[model samples]
Target chain A: MAISVDYVVRETATNLRRNLLMTTAAILTVAVSLSLVGAALLLRQGVTRATLQWQGGVELSIFLNPDIAATQRDAIKTQLDAMPEVRRVAYVDQEAAYAEFKQMFANSPDMVESVSAKDLPPSFRVVPRQPELTEIVGQRFNKREGVKEVVYAEDMVETLINFTDFLQNVIFAVAGVLLLSAALLILNTIRMAIFARRREVAVMKLVGATNWFIRVPFMLEGMVQGLVGAAASFLMLVVSRGLIASALEGNHLIEQFVVSSADVMGTGLFILAMGALVGGAGSALAVSRFLDV
Target chain B: MTATRPAPTERDHWRRQLLLTLVAVAGGIVSLRLMALSVARERDVYLVIMADGSRVRSASYLVTLWPAAVALAAAFGVFASLVVHTYRVARFTFRSDIEPSPTGELP
Candidate 1:
């Protein structure tokens, strides 16, 4: 007899009800797994935003000597600006630089009251087309005869990148362990289901039921369990994402870190698929030995 | 002389216990995964750095919990199947003396 889809569906439903606790366990497994995956994605997004913000702030500072000639200063600016890596170079004349210093030291008026514009060195605030090119521009300016010092914010960028990398590795490692544990757990649950139905299986064998016929229903039951678990996980991820985004928005530093709606939905679907596959595979494997012997 | 046979009830009881154990393990794994994910979120910056230095910020967008969840679930299903099948074979063979009719011989 050809097995109807309705028949398979009914059998799966009945099995689910009969093994309610196991079914629940399977679903929970899927939910937890999916949640971890979702959280990891969100964490990555936050790091990306922070890095981009930092990179945007990178600039080359060229400090000029106190004795540099006006004509030489202008020439240096023109040379630096001509480089393809150089996006823009604004010269901060002695007067302007001195005003900035005074403003910066405004909290202590006495400290800057005697200082004059000539005492403050002229400099160029050089913006680069790319953050990575900051080093190149800084090095070039450092070799110039009239430049006193060259500073590029390379240390800050490197530190941020290293820190982010360490975090990703840790997350991935934890995710791996969770996945291993989940598999083992599902394995045990399906084993129990098979054990409970051993008599039924023996009877089917007695009646000459094919191995495939006996295994299909249990496999279907597992798939259903996984699907349910994935659904639950998806819902939880959505709620958690909203809560996290709200909390992050309150912090100005992390306000840009938000998990979009589309991401949540996409992740949910992926989790559901995973749950079903795991459940089905677990059930099938658990029952295989019994069928063979 | 009559041969004393082992009871089917004994096998059934043992099988039930095994299934319960499996369910407990699966539940524990699920709980652990949830906890891990929560912890991971708090350390997002570090995770990005590890994924790719230049693209650390973008790494979060690429990472997803779905693959791990699905992988775990699939692994569990296979484990369950293996455990159940193994138990059945062992139980049947061990108690064959109680069942006068061989499994294949029964109608």
Candidate 2:
């Protein structure tokens, strides 16, 4: 029998309306999972931005002994400059060190006033080729001659690395679970919807209806559900992003975290594609099993 | 009198057999490919600049997400099978003549 596009569309709409509750459940599940995935993507971008800034701030300060002669300081600098771990080194004499200390501790006027150029120790500020190699640079110079101390935020760097790693694993685990749940829910919803219309399906098969004729409407129904779910999730993601940005406003630490609109849209498109696949594929599999002709 | 069933034509039988064989072969290939991917070593490498400014390769052989990769392969295989089977069945249904027997049995 020849089938009309209008008939298929009307049938799809009727199926969705008849199984409204299951359809709504499927859509909500998809929306929830997709939103979570979107949030995870955004969080990853934020962490990446923070890490880039952290890389720029990564430096090891090698403080010179107050009594160290110019020759000794030059020798230390030469040694450091030749090391494979060191990217570049800047020498800060007592006067420059004192100026930097004053600028750094400007908030504490009493401390700045009490310290003089003669009291501040000269130092070499060392940048590493890679941010992660800062530890190696510190270790190499930590006990060297003419060096009073090596200053680097080892604990802070370790904490940031641990935090990023934890976040990555957590996001993957949670998103995986949620996506699985969403796909299963879609499968179940389609199965139930087809089950309700089994009598109609049987009649169609008896009357020599082609398999595609009987399948297209159901597949379309599932696709519509997925599309709706994707749209809802996209809206939720945008609103949540706005809320998060507002909440984090004026926070100096997060002020630099910004994701381009294109990136956000790309993630949104991916979520939508996943939704469509889960819904359409889920329904197709369901009909093939339950309404086999 | 006993009712004798008509023998299915050789040509029709052969056509059906050929389609089934094709599907089976495709399924086998997919399974073999999946196995190979699963058994593959979980190693990935990318270029990075070392502290001395020379480019070097870093490997994440142990840290790769093998489970996810296998899962992705499995999903793709299943989807491909589904599409191929559905298309074949739909085409067969469209072309073949299906008639119900007196007891409502279809052939």
Candidate 3:
């Protein structure tokens, strides 16, 4: 019932070499599927992060008129703070507003240079208990004497939420389809490999070799194919990330949307594990058809 | 030869075929369920209370789609595994009698 390491390795190598075309095809398909899945996962993470950032940024900005006195601004802030619907209120003076604007448009030096500190208005940023209830806060100061305009980023948040949800659905559906096809391809390739070695398998069985002893080599072969494919795809993903980062150079806003390394590595590991499972299970099932206990 | 392997009986053949048939039927049911879920309309929404006591409306698409997808995947996996195992076992048993023994004792 005991098998040697060299024997197992030699058998696995022989099987792979004997059916080189099938092995290559299976590897390539697995690589393609896993890479797509990895990309989709990264994209999903990026969108989720962006959506959360957008949600956290959801607030109402009540811009004050240039002529509004400091005392009036303080009074408005106090009123906003007194409301139960308002979770918190922060007063941003004209100077701070100018600074934020400059930072946001740092990529566009010409635009940032053209905007003067006096051009930006001081405002109160209100965070509501519920983001969807931001309108209640917006209307509170809409027609006030010193208030110039009341605006909430709710529209942007809503649009981003819808887009993110759509993207998530597309990612999941497409990934699912690709992974399933990859599984089937692996299954077919294993079946072919087992068919070619049927006689050898039967001989082993007749010699009283354990079923596991007969099956382990085939499983190892599949695992090697899967690992090679996963590694290839993961390399491609890393290269693509570099390409994207270079493409987005100089655009700070878009640069912020880059997928994190943690996400990339996590997704890579997940795909690698999945590849192994697909390969091992596929070969096991294929060989099991010809084996009996 | 000192030993003779037991020959497969007619009942064993029928039983193996029946098992494979059942696997196929189960696969069909899984496929049907997947299709139904895919075409299912987006409804069955409910309100969820957040940690802050705020209520949020959740659509079926948001809440149920992932689980449905997972269920479909599980079904596909189980069906596929069962089909392959049964088919492999049936092939092995059917061919065992015709294939020559390793010891070259058939003659």
Candidate 4:
């Protein structure tokens, strides 16, 4: 007899109910694993966003000789403005520099009072067109007349980028490992479901029933588990999004760590798709062994 | 007597299908690795460069993160397609049957 749609659906439902506890365990494992994957993804996106908009950027400070002539300093400024690598330039006079020193040393009133405006050197603050070009831009005036020194925060920038890379690697690796475990759990669940009814399968084999007729129901059971798990995971993400954002946003430095709704939705779709794969493949492998074909 | 052995052609069919399915699984795994790389390089990172204690304009690479999304999605699609193919193959799978049953239906 030909297998009908209703037969497949009914059989699948029966199998799911027959092993209720196993089904629940598999789905819960899938949900938890997918949730971790989603959280890691959202965090990566948030951190990347915050770092791009961070206050620290490519800049250089060109300190001029205190006894430099006015014409020489003007010439240096003119040359800086003409360079393609320089985005903008600001001249910090001796008074502004002295004020900065006082602010920096405010905790030590004696130090603040000791350095007068005349003791502070004037400097040119330069922003580079690109972060990688910061060093190149600073090198230009290193030997130029009226320039005493060129300074840029090179180490700090490299450290931040490297840190983010390390973080992304660690998080994604954990997610990947968890996903594998979830897939294995799904496989075991399907195998047990099929094994419990191996006798029925042998009977069907004795008759004219095709393997597809017997296998469809089991596969569908797996798919159902996967889809349900995905739904639960998605719901969890939606419910906890506010708490996650609030916790992270409590810090002013990383207030931009909030992911957009679109990010959440996208990650949810990914989890759903992943769940389906693990389910479908898991059932196929489990049934294939018992079928001995 | 032992159950009848299947034709060589049937064995070859099963082997070919299994091999192809394995290839699909490999593709899925490779896509996952690519996704990790995509996430790492997905966006342009900005450095907080300072000149005389003052912040400067941020640099950007403008790299897109869409590839990460695409890679992950492709992995799922590839695995799902292979799984469905495997299920369809089950319809024509070869099987060995018993000549004697514990219920004494056959002697």
Best by TM-score: 4
Interface RMSD of each: 12.9, 15.9, 13.7, 12.5
Task: Give the 10-residue window scoring lowest on summed lDDT in candidate 3 chain A.
Answer: A155-164
- What does DockQ come to for candidate 3? 0.02
Q: Where is model 4 more than 4 Å wrong at Cα?
A: A1-4, A55-72, A79-88, A93-95, A105-122, A127-155, A208-211, A246-250, B1-107
**How high is the lDDT of residue A219 in model 1?**
89
Q: Flag clash pairs in model 3.
A: A289-B88
Clashing pairs counted in every model = 35, 0, 1, 3
Report chain A TM-scores, every model. 0.74, 0.70, 0.70, 0.77
lDDT value for model 3? 0.66
lDDT agreement with native, every candidate? 0.62, 0.63, 0.66, 0.66
What docking grade does candidate 2 earn?
incorrect
Residue ranges of candidate 2 with Cα displaced over 4 Å: A1-7, A61-89, A92-123, A127-156, A253-260, B1-107
How well does candidate 1 score on lDDT at residue B69? 48
User: Which candidate model has the greater TM-score, 2 or 4?
Assistant: 4
Q: Per-residue CA lDDT of candidate 3, range A1-293, in tens?
A: 89999999999999899999888877976787687678767766765765566566467778788679888988998898789988888988778876776665566687667666677777888889886678877887899988887767654235335634654555555455556556655766777677666777777788789999998999999998988888888988888878977887985444545687788888889899988998988888767877852
In angstroms, give how far residue B105 of model 2 lies from its true place.
Answer: 16
Compose the digit string of candidate 1's lDDT tens values, residues A1-293.
35667877888788889888777766766666556655555555554655566667567778788788888898887788689998888988778876776665565577567566776666788999988788877887777888777756555345435544554454444444444445555665776677777777778777787787778888898887777877887888889878867876765444544557887777678777777777888788777756743
DockQ of 2: 0.02
